[model samples]
Target: MPKMKRGSEIPHWFPLDVAGTIYPSARTRNWNYTYRSGFLLKEEVNPGLLRQALEDIHSRFPSFFVGVRNGLFWYYLERMENLDIVRRESTYPCRPMNIFSRQSPAIRILYDHRRFCLEIAHCVADGGATLTMAKALLARYLQLTGKEIPPDSGLTDLTEPPKPEELTDSYREFYVKKVGKPAPDANAWQYRPPQVLNYLKVIHGILPLEDVLPAAKARGITLTDYLMAVYLYAFYLAVPKSRRSSRQIKVSVPISLRNFFPTETLRNFSLFTNIGFDPRAKADFSFDDVLEAVKGKLAAAKTKEAMQKLLSSNVAMIQNPLVRLIPNVLKRRVLQIGYVLAGENKFTTPMTNLGRVTLPPGVAEHVEQVEGILGGSAQKRINCAMISDERFLHIYFSGDTKRTEVQREFFRLLAREGIRARVECNIREEEDVE
Candidate 1:
């Protein structure tokens, strides 16, 4: 096995793996997703203990310590000089978990400037991997602190993971190939608010996950319905009169396909379901009535036909090899047109309910709670995320700087409605970095 390299070898391979010859594997390309959280440590983070934790991280997701390419997806698994993995450190800058993870490897760890806050980036693991790493680290901390026993680490339960063939290979093929697109030289996203006075931004705040559902029960709606109502209502009110006088607006709510598909793996497994509100119908409606409509839309988005059609669209794309390789430039152009056609007619924001996080018991000694943030390539419309624990909800709002003010206000409005939500800003300029 080759040793761990210090930096990423972007030229390692293309359209195949460097580690081995290409196989007709239907697995998705190793895409990158950033998941990070902040937590307080009762004590200072000891370099030694932290180092041990980093090694522990490697034991499970070691592939993260190495680089990946279109074909071969692995690091030299052998140890170098009995001290380090092959091709150890290159030139990636130092991150929070610099000792075990690469500064520029597929994965990274960064520290929050102000506190013992740790932010980890999992280039390989998706949202599911983030949760897994967080749980593992939390549990290890408990052990280091001498607080609790090791949490259950069993994955032998052969019950989950969707069947591979069942996945829409077309979606997998498209998503990765799209990544190969040569991003603009500036790397800056282009977006203009509908108008100066009319802006749509993410609202951040935590609501008791338990409270949300119970509150819905009282109102005879599901938690998803109640939250959707709030989001759609806020969005409708924000529409400029110029636009309000015209068409409908919809929100792209994402639904996870974990259960629907037999696979429970960390692979990308989500589909967007657009929900729209007709101003004519909603303008005269009360919040309760809107809630009912939201509930109905949520129900319809999950029907067998909805998913089947979506799958068909994705699968159809894979059947065209020529279309898949039309160069990233052409693909971006296609996407731009597609985005235009989709219009701003759907939901103005993306709200993802990570749902209540349940970790294996005894992991983080004296466990508190775990929450995360969701940021995307687009700098416009904020991506709002909420994850709940037994009592508290962790809400994260992230978007381009242009949307900050509105995001804060949205949280304030939620609190005004007596929902007991707290907004925490993760702005680098505003907050002290660790």
Candidate 2:
């Protein structure tokens, strides 16, 4: 590994990515848009070695090792010198972060028993970047434990200096002038059950990938398409029949631009499209009906041309002269109102699939499970994220509502299809028992 440098020696500040600009403004005292990505190892974690690994790998990921700062017109990132941020899990995963405090880093390195997790603020980076950092950290941790993990794309080699390309904000790089912005979406149906203040209930449905993969293939759709269909169907079943026609049941699925654009930037490079149908329009929609709708929406939205328009729309907003002239103080309020008017309310729930996670043979051997967890918002109280290994696809639902009807119905639908899941949660046994 290369020797570490003092923070002053390196570039000390960075601009927020186009997608990240909205997160800081949307944050409240109690909640922020955060997500977690990490692995559950087969053996108990050693905190000493884990902390050492974090210190060892910190310099290699400059984009992630920083704190948020309030600029005159926008929020920016200022690098933090302290690397001793690892700690035992003392609170729930993806809890609110103190990003404004220079003393606090935007990312959390947490360990509990055999679980090693990275809880990151969305303002720092997107899922793809966070996953890369998590893989590198896991590899470093294992290597420190005397494991001979070979270099792979999944793991960032600590020996090399941070690349300039990894820090580029690809949105501006690829934005095209005159590209028309996509149409705005109507407000979708919201499942606002009673709140469980400050508490996030997590449920993991671990299913064999073999069963799930064939199920998707049999339907002639991708795994994401299959899951989105089941998710919409679950909502249809969970909600009362009387309320089904209230509004569209839209699910926001984030599409990584790395798949479409040629960029290695670790910053946020993704945009989400709302995929759903109006229950009023399709009065008697079946599973097959929902699957076909999801497929059509995904097919249209996932194309390079469609994504470029969406990306340009986002970049265009920030580039507007009127938007740029607003001071940071009022800009916060404007952005907050804009988010409420056009953001979270437009989607009933968000489901992100990190796809298959591959680790080097040496590191994969020590890992038992890997999954991604999305944080719930005040408006969209229930959200889902999934990541899979060769054996099992781990579907995690993180919710702040008192009810679990949506989650239960989702897993039940899978069970009815002969796809069984081993369920787990953070709630008490008494509370979780049906």
Candidate 3:
């Protein structure tokens, strides 16, 4: 790989929506995200293959530093332990991508010494950037084996991924406006993942994402409006009832801030709205009604006053350095407090509509598929991640393993509705990376 140009580490910084909800989430989750991408290798990987792959990546994307401050800065301690590069393990850290740490552990490491996988800290790069790293890894591995691996290319080479940030950042301040305050109520059932994996089931299926989107357009609703409506139904069902129309169901959907707001492209570029359902409109609720309501809410949220209110709500609390210095245990307690304040009646689940996936004409020839993963943390119970092309509704989720059954039932619900299904799951195993 060629060396980076002088001062090549310069980055474009943007804000991340999750950064707003600091306390009620795991440090790894609050700040960073870990995800893996791999394939059943055409052949077994030689021990040396991954080490050289990472080394080459570090050389070019070298500024992968951590603990950055002042937005655009990146700080990397140049010692071996500082970055924690593992030759045998294929582990390394760069700068923080999301609020997550830089030198984080690899998610899909050398498990069983056979399965080849890579774990990435979201802080260093968003899913789009990380997928590029995976592509580089594959290209390098192929080259090591003396195959005719093509020259310098990857995910960026695939689709003109509108820096989702570019599209949304222009309206960063308007993020929380569309989200309504939840009406008072008793809380929904909450869940947390355990140390050991024990979910009822982990299943995945693909349908035409386009099909659902058009359904929204038909109703004059946006994709998010439609999906959030689905979650509201799921939330209603998840609850044990005596139907209380007064109960509020809330959801927080991260709004990309690249194009909406003005900012350098270095940091995370996203904002989110904590939207909720008010019972006054609940008794007559149907998906269509919910869709229209969400559209209205979204429109109001994009206004300037909405953004100001969101900023005022948390600005003072976070700016207090003492808030950042509290012991993590205490911090978690405070987070729970804020979470409860948002309303015990917050949405039962989070439906993250990741919009669409744009693919270059023939990239599928190289990669059979690329799935976007959305994992839930303490602040949210369940996450529904959707990525669509013209023909497929690609969906996936990660939550408390115990919720696996719930997810399965949901998938079944989708299938019964007549969507074609193609599934892939690696959750129920003693050895996962394998």
Choose the strongest candidate by lDDT: 2
Off by over 4 Å in 3: 5-51, 59-118, 121-201, 242-246, 264-266, 279-285, 302-317, 320-346, 359-362, 404-409, 412-417, 428-434
lDDT of 3 by residue, 382-421 (tens): 5666656446766666554444544655555445545456
Sort by TM-score, best first: what order? 2, 1, 3
TM-score of each: 0.67, 0.96, 0.64
What candidate 2 gets wrong by more than 4 Å, as runs, is 4-9, 152-154, 430-434
TM-score winner: 2
Worst 10 residues of 3 by lDDT: 72-81
Candidate 3 local distance difference test against the native: 0.47
266 Cα displacement, candidate 1 (Å): 2.4
Evaluate all candidate structures by whole-model CA lDDT and list the values in order. 0.46, 0.88, 0.47
Off by over 4 Å in 1: 1-44, 62-103, 113-123, 145-147, 151-204, 209-211, 243-245, 325-347, 402-409, 427-434
Q: Evaluate candidate 2 by giving its C-alpha RMSD to the native, one decimal.
A: 1.8
Order by lDDT, highest first: 2, 3, 1
TM-score winner between 1 and 2, please give it.
2
Model 2 C-alpha lDDT per residue in residues 1-434, reported as the tens digit of each score: 66745453457899999999999998988899889998999999999999999888888888898889999999999888677678898876788888887776888888999998988889889999999999889998998989898665456778877888888899999999887878778998888887776788899889999899999999998899899999998998899887655789999999999999999898899999999877876658888888877886787889998899999988999999999999999999999988888888898899999999988889899999997999868578899999999799999999887689999999999998889789989887685433
